[model samples]
Target: MIKRKFFMTFIVFFFLFPLQIAAETIEEPDVSSEAAILMDAKSGQVIYGKNEFVRMNPASITKIATAIYAIENGVLSDQVVVSEQATKVEGTTVYLEPGEIVSLEKLIIGMVVNSGNDAAIAIAEHIDGSLTNFEKNFNVYLQDYIGVSSTHFENPHGLYGENHYTTAYDMARITQHAMENEIFRSIFKIQEYEWDGESWDTTIVNHHRLVLGEFPYDAEITGGKNGFVSQSGFTLVTTATKGDLDLIAVTMKTNLKNEPYAETLSLFDYGFNNFKTEVIPKGSKFTVDNEEFVAEDDLIYTVNIHDKVSNKINPSGVLSIYNGENEQIASFNLKSLSAPVTKNITDENEENWQANGFLGTMELAILGVSAIIVVLVIQKLRKRA
Candidate 1:
């Protein structure tokens, strides 16, 4: 009876312990949406996600591509002539009338800041001469530069079409690329915009809720894009910065349920609370003067991880060794640096040149070819003899 009781207790402990550990493990947030993704914009690490690769309508998030194309190709100061087709695009508008004139910059502000559909069409047509041609260009652009395999665009506004859909991973990648440009980052970060024209008078308010910092989680939203359509549902791709780490969180295909904003806040808290950068030194040697190259010491050279993480009572700190832009040119790892210098062999250093690598290979090939020629010549001489 004692052995049986002990066996039963052991079985119970084994089963119950696994359950407890599983409960304690960090589970993906229960976002109400069918599809969602969260990535670290700085590192492009997807911290948490569900159905991230499943393609679905991106709604107004399509504007991220539109905005990038405009900034790359169009002159912001140039006034664009709004065509009849652009003004007639159904859905959200900054109310641009036909023949209405607005600066390219203002159109971007309206497109991104307000999620204006008409503004998207206007910008697209302006940038590419026509929406149809613009869309083909946009698809090629995504494939070439952005590497989004599952994305296709039918309309500039992302209003609705069977062929118009994008995966969450591709959308995150698009955000990552867009955020790299200073101007694009600035436009998306804005919460409000007042276009600079009388007839096109409108105050554009951003649709991204987290950008306003209303969530109780107290995370700072550095950048984001918001999208919504009847078929696509409410969607938001937001990047929030906590300490030095930046996280990009995306939610889609839901009616704003599961408190996505709150989930984002929780994600930020988890990320900031848990992980940190561990800076390791990049170079094997640092050259101080023309004559002297020294192996790095902790006092003279150090690994500069951007942030250090600690527990609830103690927070992280920045770890930096070098300062000034030019002085810190050695910050990146050796792989990031240019290939090592290759010196040509000369009469002064023929012996040293044969040590290894390209020079050695070239010298060996030359010697082998010369020896073969000499042997052929000797064979010909023997025949003549």
Candidate 2:
């Protein structure tokens, strides 16, 4: 009886415990969105997504593209003269009167924080001398930098138009590009923004609920942009971070009241509570025994990561060893680094270099001998191993 009990306990510990890996259950947020997606901004890993590739009107999310083009071409501190067309832009406005002088920085605040359609138009007109030319620049930037294939911009305001559309996946991709720039990032997170004594307040406080207080979830929402129109419904592009996992969520055509925001919160809860980021180091000097490895002052590798994985998940990364000509020599498990690794020969690592040199020479010698033996045997038996 004692033996049987012990055996049963062992079975449970080894078999059941291993299989008890946490799973990320995506609760379809109580939303009526036509398209949605959750992705890691850094790794571009999709956590939870629905109709991610379907294209639809982007609403005010168009400002993300507008902002990107402005950052690249002009300075934020530069003064802009509001044009008649910009002042007359329909819908949301920063109330810029014609010929009113404003800095490009204030316009960005209005564009992102206020979602001011007039500010977007003013900046667009200032950048390209006309809205039509600015839109041409936005489309080119979207194609080249943001990598949104299905996205097309008919206007900068994101007002309902014939061809103004983007997929959830494409919008997420656009957010990824926008987040990489510091100026664009800083403006997105500002809860309250002031522009020439006119302040634009957020309609729904904490566009990303996790970043604010008293939510059903906990996370560091880096920053985000929100959008809405009668045609596009409620739309959002939000960024959240927990541990090493940073994610971007996009929702389009959802209920304006609480559905999109609540859904995003739930998805983040699932992601952080159940999943963890797995950092798989591509190359380890200790394992590979290559003296030449990590010789570059600025080292970079082709890093591939599997993200939003269960805490118990231990995915074996695919590592292919190569030669000078990019020929595949061998493949094996890659060892991960627990801390930042310093590559190159240093005074402290003299012993490591000696050991690495010995190992490298022995490996080469073994290969040479094996090749010679195979060649000799081929002559003797007319066959070789």
Best-performing candidate as measured by lDDT: 1
For residues 136-188, what per-residue lDDT tens digits would candidate 2 score against the true structure?
A: 88898889877779999988879999889889999888888888889888877
Task: List runs of model 1 lying over 4 Å from the truth.
Answer: 1-24, 278-385
Tell me the tens digit of each residue's lDDT in model 1 across 308-327: 21211101122223322213
Q: Per-residue error at 347 for model 2, in Å?
A: 38
What lDDT score belongs to each candidate, Candidate 1 first?
Answer: 0.72, 0.70
Query: After superposing candidate 2, which stretches have Cα over 4 Å from the reference?
Result: 1-17, 20-31, 197-217, 281-385
Q: Which ten residues in a row have the lowest lDDT in candidate 2?
A: 304-313
Q: Indicate the residue-level lDDT of 349 in model 2.
A: 95
